[model samples]
Target: MTQMRFGQGTNRITGTVVMDRRTKCLVKRIQPGQIAVIDHPDLDEVAAEELVENRVRAVINAASSISGVYPARGAAYLIRSGIPVVDRAGADIFCRLQEGDRIWLDHDRVGKVGESQAVVRGERLSAQTVWEKIHQTQSHFNQTVVAFMENTLHYAVSEKRWFMRPLAVPGMYTQLKGKQVVVVVRGTGYKEDLAAIYHFIKAERPVLIGVDGGADALLQCGWKPDVIVGDMDSVSDEALCSGAELVVHAYPNGDAPGLERVEKLGLAAHILPGMGTSEDVALLLADQEGAERIIAVGTHSHIIDFLEKGRNGMASTLLTRIKVGGKLVDVSGIRHFYPPKTERRRKAPLWAAVFSAPMAVAALPGSFTIDDSWLRMVWLSLRLWYFP
Candidate 1:
């Protein structure tokens, strides 16, 4: 670490800057000790987690990390992780600087090397300030919920027809009748959730449906998708060619945004024209196609999640859940339901163990009764002798 002469009581961070308007895309290229310049407002938790993982020197955001629209956890997460954040730095800073430009950021002042004046300025966010904002956001939760409900009701009246009016369920090359389906979405807590259900996936061999980039998540877990469904965005080319049946999501008007991408790869995809999120679409596909049960991984189901997604409402998710009914199961908190695997021991009754051994005398059936603890001790001694 380099120590520069600062005007006392301020730390100066010296590093090359990596700028991107999209934080999610920016995280893929950012490395440790380099500053990140992002334009994402109300940054989501997933983006924040990635930034914390990258060990960035500092974050200079063009937009407000917390807009107070809802209780966003991004700025707080980064701040709590001990990464300094400069919030609301004007967008013009991007025009003044280029990627890989070595710069110094001290408190709210940011500038190039040897520059007499600071090139751009912003408010350095503190844990206390953001937490106070978060508290206020929570206090006004009812207002946000009411607004979200009104928005949802408005859209629900228009979208209910699409969800309830019989969506055309296309024939899948992979049969779903009476079979279990696992719909994987690369949302928050997805990795931990996926790890929790690994045994179920291995044992049941349920059909895997990856929604967009979730296909990449499945591949990372060493499992290939049986059917990949989304608007063809966010999913990588490698996952597209992983032999999974492609199902492209199109708008209700039949405009397929991802069709050209699929065509370019010479891949034939089944068009599932529907109105809803890709996660909702995947759920409906599994249900309408006769999947016995649909296990959802990383699907957004919480109010906080909808807020982070910048959604005023989730009419699609709500309607889809109503239609799909109770067969949908989420993998969140599954670790509590299905605990981690541990070692097991095999043992029989002491009478059985003794009789099995040659030249071993067993007590008469009526003479003595062997207790569980005694049987366990005998088994442990024998196991130690053999296993050792």
Candidate 2:
């Protein structure tokens, strides 16, 4: 990819427009140096990172980039990365502009080429403004938290009765009994978290469960998910066709929109009827199927994450965590869980260790006159660093 300085332009940009109502879907089609037109309100961190990865020339949002409801930082991220974002561009602009149409962004104004009048004009989000709004929103954090808890409890009461009933789990071919399971989600910093756990995954050989677009994340990292779970909205067709077992999460009313997509692909999927989020279902499934331990990577675990995902209540997640808390561990940044590049009982041969002792001592800082006690002190100090 070429280097990009997003907001360094002359307050103007002219490029082919790539428009999509869904920002996640749009990222797949967007190319560097192309303009992106999206209608996402309260754009979240994941979408912003994806957009940054694509290196779009600029972003034009038909909806508020930061609604000030709770400080969604999509605009801030783009701005900080030097990306110019024109916010609240008219919704009808989507109707007027076609994909691949050349357009012009003149500061706050957007219009098609050769047109004297601008199609839509919105407030340009600058770093100062976005941060100001974010700080202002922070002041209301307590209020948002209180309301969030109240709503969660309100919904939890109604949803608890459903949990009391038995959940009909689909028969799965993939074995989970006594196996360590890694449930992946496309949350903030998921890529980094996955990278941090690379050695742990290689050594332990955990069962990989990708939640929706997280399946694509695994495929990108050269790991094929054993079970792909979600409503199948953000995941790509390539991921769905990766020979992974499809377990679609269905609603309480038995509506399975994701199942329809699976059927269209000629892929067989087991429908899991549940009331909680798809990630919750994935965890509960693994726990019930006898997974010895569940490692959650990028799963939403806090109130802000729930708010960003547009969930007013995390009752299902709350209940599922309570049920599986014994074996569940969120390994988002805990890379030290396992030593790097080493597995249990896989020490070097005794002959190799003995043969290298002299060479190891020779390579140390001290001259050959160094005492044996000093060498031992240094060796002990470096033992942890040599784990790799």
Candidate 3:
């Protein structure tokens, strides 16, 4: 095993190095006090949140954390979380350092312990620098918007069927006809929004759909998805075995890579080939199932959400919105509107039970009848117990 060195300075951290070119994949392998080596450029907020949750000792980036193309609040999140981040450390670090190799990440350099030569040297990211970069990038954000719009229109023209016609979605066991369906995606503020709508979910009993890793998110919240739909790359084996109806989102050519993963796990899944993204397919599936209303949590709707996913074109999502318009409500809107409906519906049953209880007692035989004062007392007791 490789040995690590611990120094006295606050700016130095020594730990085992875990390297992956994919930020999300690396996050799964990393542990607390381990050094994460990743090649993610323009790291988004979701990735940063995972890194912070894992409590990695430090992050060494082969690519620039923020390319100034967009706000890319990931680096800012890391810095704010007090996790040291070394940016633009060069791709050579991957070739030079092996996984599980112990290394020392100093304020300015990273290298194997007891070595005088540094393997990767890069600038440490500070909150001030991140804030400044974001401010500078925001001023030029119009260019990004223009480019995104162009790409969206270009792809929208090619993929207009998704918006124009009804999707041929596979039959699902979960009945959604005239029922509320909540489609969950692993996007910004998903956790917060899910938590905020917890009462609504319990009260309304909506069909829950998870898109890829969104299944894991739902599981984390003590809820099992009624349907899990996506590429199946990010979801865990346990989630695959979760008994939810699996719907693999395939390419336009009917190539379903996620199906193999499901089969390997000895699980059956329905293949749904579509033109748009997995989330788009999810919404279309709900609509096809005759869902009365679709509540979306953590689904990206904004241009920045698409750009952060490195998607310049949101043709699929744009078309999906057009197709599901007036039926889909975002989490924010749900939080505002759903509670009243939930409360109203919840109270109706309680009120019915309350009124029916007295009627039920009154329907008893005359021999079982009690004084008016006793009956009033019983009603009062029932009211307190049921309403409280």
Candidate 4:
């Protein structure tokens, strides 16, 4: 419980990195010469590489798995680079912190006014200044992403398995007809969505399913997924431990590197190696599993949602929509569903019991007197039964 002190004033945030967007991480935010913080637990390698190239001051893992469980490669790399990480709170905590809200690392190690301006102070920030820094950082990020994708694709192609089903396009998966299933995706407000999923499961009892990264969310909530379909990035070790059926999407050329991670986890998972995006693969699994109504928790259908996840193009998604039009029922907004409270009734059984007890007391009248404790118990039961 270390407290941070900040002058009651505002400061410039030149070197500060803001990973507030939950859907897709911002490359510019963690660019070189900036202090980086990830608002989500699941960060793709692409995002991690960008932060590394920039040499960020400190990284705050605002995800639930910040310290309780084993850290992911992204956070691990930051720690290895001598960049301190303080995982004090979840993603929601970022909204309260300001640009100059005096950040203290690891409870009280490195202290600084959490402002981006500190990035370009020469003595503090670095040699790169202004737009050039952004340009160079983005350039490195692009190259890294290309390399990462190539390596991933190579590994995917190397692993050939039966469950691996290659889709015709990305973001397009087969649809199901009548099986009960839930489509779990990473939402902006994931914790809230997790709560909703818990309630939804309690009421509907749908076969809990996770779409790629969402499997990790399910694991966080202590609900083992019945099935998991995705490319395999951003999913944690606990997710693989869920023992749910796994389907890996492969490229048309038969690349499915995500399957390799599944294998590395020492768990046997089904690989539906396909060419589609992870979401598409998930839908395909639902169809293959014969799921009836698909209840999606944090899926993205709108272009904005895709963009937030850093997708440059949407043709694949549009085509996929056309393919699975009927079977898909997006419940992205259903996170607000809460169970209603029980109502009180006037004709409660407690009143009948109360009257019966009084009659019994009257019948035993002239001879003996009932104990006060018994009378109190009767009155209490009457109140409880009569009230909600």
Error of 3 at 197 (Å): 0.5
Model 3 clash pairs are none
Q: How do the predictions measure up, each by TM-score?
A: 0.81, 0.85, 0.84, 0.49
Best by lDDT: 2
| Candidate 1: segments with Cα more than 4 A from true spot | 1-10, 263-266, 335-388
Tens digit of lDDT per residue, candidate 4, span 179-224? 5778787654454566655644654667777877688678777778
The list of candidate 4 runs beyond 4 A from truth reads: 3-177, 336-388
Per-residue lDDT tens digits for candidate 2, residues 206-227, read 9999999989989888899999
Question: What is the total number of backbone clashes in candidate 2?
Answer: 2
Q: Specify the poorest-scoring 10-residue window by lDDT in model 2.
A: 336-345
lDDT of 3: 0.84
Model 2 lDDT at residue 77: 88
Sum up the clashes in candidate 1.
Answer: 0
lDDT of 1 by residue, 50-110 (tens): 8887888888999988887788889888887878888899899899989999998888889
TM-score result, candidate 4: 0.49
**lDDT on C-alpha atoms for all candidate structures:** 0.82, 0.84, 0.84, 0.53
Arrange candidates by TM-score, descending. Answer: 2, 3, 1, 4
